[model samples]
Target: MADMNFTGPEPDLNELLAARPQLGLHAQDGLCLENVPLNAIADQYGTPVWVYGAQTMRARFAALRDAFAAETVPMHIHYAVKANDHLAILNLFHEQGAGADVVSIGEFLRATKAGIAARDIVYSGVGKSEAELETALSAGIGQINAESAEEVDMISAIAARLGVVANIALRMNPDVDAGTHAKITTGLAENKFGIAAADIPALYARASGLPGVRVAGIAMHIGSQILSTEPYRHAYGKGAEMVRALREAGQSVEVLDLGGGLGIGYQDGPGLSPAAFAAMVRQATNGLGVKLMMEPGRYLVGPAGLLLASVILRKQTGKRFLVLDAAMNDLMRPAMYEAWHGILPVDAAAFQGMATPADVVGPICESADQFAKDRILPDLRPGARVALLDAGAYGAVMSSAYNARPRAAAVLVDHGGFELITRRQEPEALWDGEIVPGA
Candidate 1:
């Protein structure tokens, strides 16, 4: 019930590295992700690149899986594709025995292309189009989360036309406040995410009667970057009550898709503990006897990555502005959600220097291109490099080519080395497929 807003004194470099165990600050070599120095990566890949620690991601998944296992709960983890949709990341999760939770046909296809089995993908989104639904049904995904009666009807019609039964779970809007950012909250009644909890019974009946629809269970996703389990306890409790009501009415319920929103510390703070979260799930849905599925996106990848950018130039008028080549187009969370990401110098010596307040900004024309305001960091010169910590999830995936700046490259670090997963967008490729109508 306390304010969920992130607030605290600025964490020093040691504190930042301590909170994120995957990052290490070497006395001479500088900051290293996993085992490879971030400077080495920036030197090779150039500035404004995304560097991910493969082992960190793997360990996070294991921790979550183990947490559920310890609670004696059978949980199927579907890595939320929208968080970071790079194929390499998806493939890594898939190889680790995780499924894919996707929102679009493109994501579904990307999951499959990443070697996730078609039956292991869960297609979820409020505005699924006819084409998207048809594609999902064609691929025979594990389940389609229906957000409305109209969506159920559409799925039924499409499945009937294709002569294939579509497995579905009604996404119930429990109207629970997840205590996250208002823009990211999806379970509120006003938000356009899921079906009303009151309408589920009748809609479940309708879905049962539909020829090509198979009612699997229920799903609820309150919001993203949720740092507490209280909202989930409330939402899952409501979902369990609904399942009991449905089963009492002689309807079969088998799956409970507890969509993920586990938050991570972007500022050396604690996030929702996986063990605590699993315990909440166990306590809430104890007697339900349904298979549990979680779609974790940020929790698994957020802390494992950082955005590497080089200082472009220092400008001082009334205030200091440390400009970088990266922009909001490269990492939009700050601009979009007013999010916070720890900025650390890539060089350990620089990080150890005297700290000063400055606005860390990007080359974008928009004023919102700023990464941090009045942020305290060691004085940085042009050509010096810095890393925006905890950007593995929403950073690169949400990037765009705004202001004619091409998207940055992405690299995965592991085994004392790194490999480029996505190359930096070439300037000419921006117009490769774009056409001038009159020309």
Candidate 2:
């Protein structure tokens, strides 16, 4: 495969993550991404692993929640469990009095299992299974962000079958293009996510007036990994407008969901502070007179976690490549988004050793498994440990068993103590249900 061209004005990873909140550490810490004591973990649990800071997760949630307290409209900081489904992380959010915004029944189970009450879980997804509906209703889930008119009917019908009315919310697609990566944006008119704005009113009327459903409010989640607040402004403005129209048509639109796109800085990211993003949101819905629900996936956890990998090889001569044990299967954003994630030496060897610019690639068989096509690094050897910065959100959650490589183990570090949250997967574990067709 041919090498992609790289030149001009590339961001300074060393300086950017050095100052960002989620990625920043105490001065002279000499680490980014995990910023954990890599030497300690490597000796204890080995490399190519994931670790999260529980205290950081709690702090970020509290920061976002506190920012909107002045609104007087009431709010719930629902942790989108899809980001990192570790029970420790969910339990931490629970202890902070946060709720869970789940997209699937599995996540629903995880939140509840992690001590979150069923009433605190809010389910939202485009294609939900029927069993998921029954499970939520039986579990007494607080609300459902219904994405379609059919889903509205289905939820009502499912509740009817279960003899309990399910709480519901209309996931309105204000058609606000959350200007972000194409793979993550979902609120546009044609995206297969929420229902169109034009049809939400009638759908709500049907669900609210129906016998087996409680119309709680309106919800909208445009996309994920969103860095700008402009899309949120557009979403809230348009959503509030819809809420007003619905109220005039004899509907009490009590909840307004701006949908979480508040992104953490990755790839020379200029930190997106939770407090700042929340304050911006506060200004948008200042007098909307509705309780706000934000389904944040990345912002809540992205900065709190890091993926630690060991450099396996460094090739030079032609378009240099810094190969690491972590591949596309480990963190897919690089290959998927041409994304920029600040990669740092756990030891800051680049500072003490010779400096050079080279592509940080992975050991994956494919050429696309490269993390940074041309990144500056302090000449690395095979054993030096490095980290992928701002990986707390979509990092481990998106890893796959590609190339039959066993998924890495996941851990959490809190109060300077560490615990293994998810065990390393074995190759045979992937074939848990193996059986010959003839047999």
Candidate 3:
């Protein structure tokens, strides 16, 4: 069995807030996200709500774009929709001149519905169904990143049936470890993601022959939460070599889709800076005139949002447990990835109290629903609220209706105001489509 890697020591609230400038605290307002006090949000919208900063997303997008532009690298950013599929978020990116990187038909449709042109959306996934391929081709998507030879053939047949040319990039597995968790790594040889690097050349040749396929270029995504740039240096360096070799072999490779796994500072630690990342890209793909593209998901939104939860009760049975009304069903990253998210009290007075180590848990029945264990936090009384920081990416998108717990509401905040984008799921909505036997 593979060894598990856990998060290191948690950072204090001050450090966490300092790392994320979008969040602020006030004497009277307590915690404020992008000019709107979170306590006000909790009072009006109730707890277990997701709050996102629109201005933060816009700023991050511009920062990434400017970084690549500063190095004079022709890069196109396709927002990875799977990270946060909310239409409001998608529309925000689209408004910022970003494209969409979708993995399924549903995401594809969402992107289109959010005013993103079909020509600006790239379809990528390991296991796309025939129906999905047909839909993408029919919609005239910009490109389809074929992950396997089987998928290459599948796209060919589907595009031929639709009488359209399917733009494609062969997603190559570079066999490089991204130095991230085992569950999220994709570039390794053992992972079931992209096609093997050796297999790409032959598959590219095969794809060119299909009447319905246009071989655009290559694509790769090593893993998620990648901190260091060395793995990318190795992967993109190899990718550059492959492009040169393929061009020598008479392939017209016009695009290099460097799929995104750029990490965020979840623990208030330093993350890979956009400038540093762009510098690496400049060096790795230098003089390779192909148009560069990236599919960033978390890096743009991870630090721009958080989860708001209220304390339900404080259980003291030999050990202290801070039970919250929000459970794994609302934000599953902790329960799913053993992920670390800084928890901050929503009251100014709470921060003044003495800190103690306690288990921060949720209302979920399973023991795995715990968020933090033996973590130092200030005394939080019942009815007090806390914000789970750095939860913007995989928080609400991964939520479930487990234990009949309704999914939480989502809000988008801007300059001194907030708007509820997604309403809290009604309890009856969970079984809206279910039918009793013989009813």
Candidate 3 residue lDDT tens string, 300-414: 9899889999999999999899999999988888777878888999998777789998899998899988888887888899999999988899888899999999999999998
- Quantify how close model 3 is to the true structure by its C-alpha RMSD in Å: 1.7
TM-score to native of every candidate shown: 0.98, 0.92, 0.98
Q: Which stretches of candidate 3 lie over 4 Å from their true place?
A: 1-9
**Model 3 worst lDDT run, 10 consecutive residues:** 1-10
* lDDT, candidate 2, 1-439, per-residue tens: 1111122465564575555554443345556333456556666777788978877777777777777774443677788888888888889889999889898999999999999999998898899988899999998999888888888888888899889988788888878776677788888888998888888888878788887888978898888766667777778878878888899999888888666777765644444665567677777777778888877778778777778899898788777878899899999877887777767777744555666678888888998898886666787888988877768887787899999888998888866667788888877898888898997
Model 1 C-alpha lDDT per residue in residues 218-280, reported as the tens digit of each score: 999999999888999999999999999999999999999999999888788878899999999
RMSD of candidate 2 to the truth, in angstroms, is: 3.0
Best by lDDT: 1
Instruction: Give the C-alpha lDDT of model 1.
Output: 0.92
Q: Each prediction's Cα lDDT score?
A: 0.92, 0.78, 0.91
Please give the TM-score that candidate 2 achieves against the real structure. 0.92
Which pairs clash inside model 3?
none
Off by over 4 Å in 2: 1-8, 11-13, 21-36, 70-73, 437-439
